[model samples]
Target: MIQRIQTIYLLIASIVSGGLIFVFNLWKTLKEQIFVLDLFEEGLFTLNVVPFMFITSSILSLVTIFLYKNRKLQFVIGRIIILMNLFLLGLLIYLSLTLSGETIVSEKGIGMFLPILVVLLIVLANKAIKKDEDLVKSVDRLR
Candidate 1:
């Protein structure tokens, strides 16, 4: 079960979300690079929503990997991860627009694209899960 293709997809998704997160900068300012924590230096609670979502998505992907015994549930969780990534992508776009200022002259980072990749990975996992479910149903019909 652990050796299934969907497990590999989920593992890669988790690695992308959890591991690659820190390797890339979210965005850069004229004054400094990201991971600067300047957004939080002002002591605002509403900041850092993107990083939080990323961590949540990573955890969900990891959890989904272990639910191989329940294909239906695993498929549902995969859908949830897709929706989460979509939401994260939307939020990232919005924030980038706002952060660019009225002149729209800030550099966007590659990290923003991570959500799209995650969504793709989750969809592949869901597809594999569905295929597994269909196989099980076919075998049951044979009996």
Candidate 2:
């Protein structure tokens, strides 16, 4: 289970969703204050869901890594994570666009793009999991 290629992909996703957020700033304000999901000020109240989603996705990725015995469930969870990340990406984009022109938030950071990367990694992991599931089904049919 741990030896599977999906394990590696999930691990990387965990790092991106959990660890990288602290290191990467989400956006810069006019006062030169860099903000991350968790470090946002009071004015960023509307975007509070960002932190919760990131943490949830990170935890889900880790949980999926251990449920290697259930490939179908793992694949489903992967799909959930992908959708969550895509929603996060869209939210970030919409917020950035609405706040355009350096009024409050300006110059989006690399962190805004991290969801795309996580989505890609999760997709690859899901593909691998699906491949494993298909191989198992094929073997079971031989019996």
Candidate 3:
């Protein structure tokens, strides 16, 4: 179970959502002075939700990894995590686009893309889980 490729994928997804988010800034603002905004720092009210979403996604990934025996459930949870990441990605895009007035967002940070990475990892994990399920079903048919 723990040795499965899906487990590894889920673990990496958790790490990306939980650990890497703090290491990178989300965006830079050029309002007389240039400064970076990490997930915790408040920019837009909606942007504040990003950190919470990341934490939730990380927890969900960890939970899904442990549900390896139930491949169908694991796959379902992975889909939920993917949707969560998609929501976060949309919010990030909204924040970047709506930045107004003196504070023009000069650049988007690598952290802004973390959700996309998480989504990709979750998708891979789900694919692996599906493969495992199919294998189990085929083995049952042989018996």
**Of the candidates shown, which would achieve the greatest TM-score relative to the real structure?**
2
Measured on C-alpha atoms, candidate 2 has an lDDT of 0.88
lDDT of 2 by residue, 3-37 (tens): 99999999999999998998888887766645555
- State model 1's lDDT: 0.82
Q: Global lDDT of each model?
A: 0.82, 0.88, 0.83
Provide TM-scores for the models: 0.90, 0.90, 0.88
| Residue pairs of candidate 1 with colliding backbone atoms | none
The number of residue pairs in model 1 that clash at the backbone is 0
lDDT of 3 by residue, 36-63 (tens): 2344575666766877898999999999
Candidates 1 and 2 compared: the better one by lDDT is 2
**Cα-based RMSD of candidate 1:** 2.2
Q: What lDDT would candidate 3 get against the real structure?
A: 0.83
RMSD of 3: 2.7
For candidate 3, the per-residue lDDT at 96 reads 73
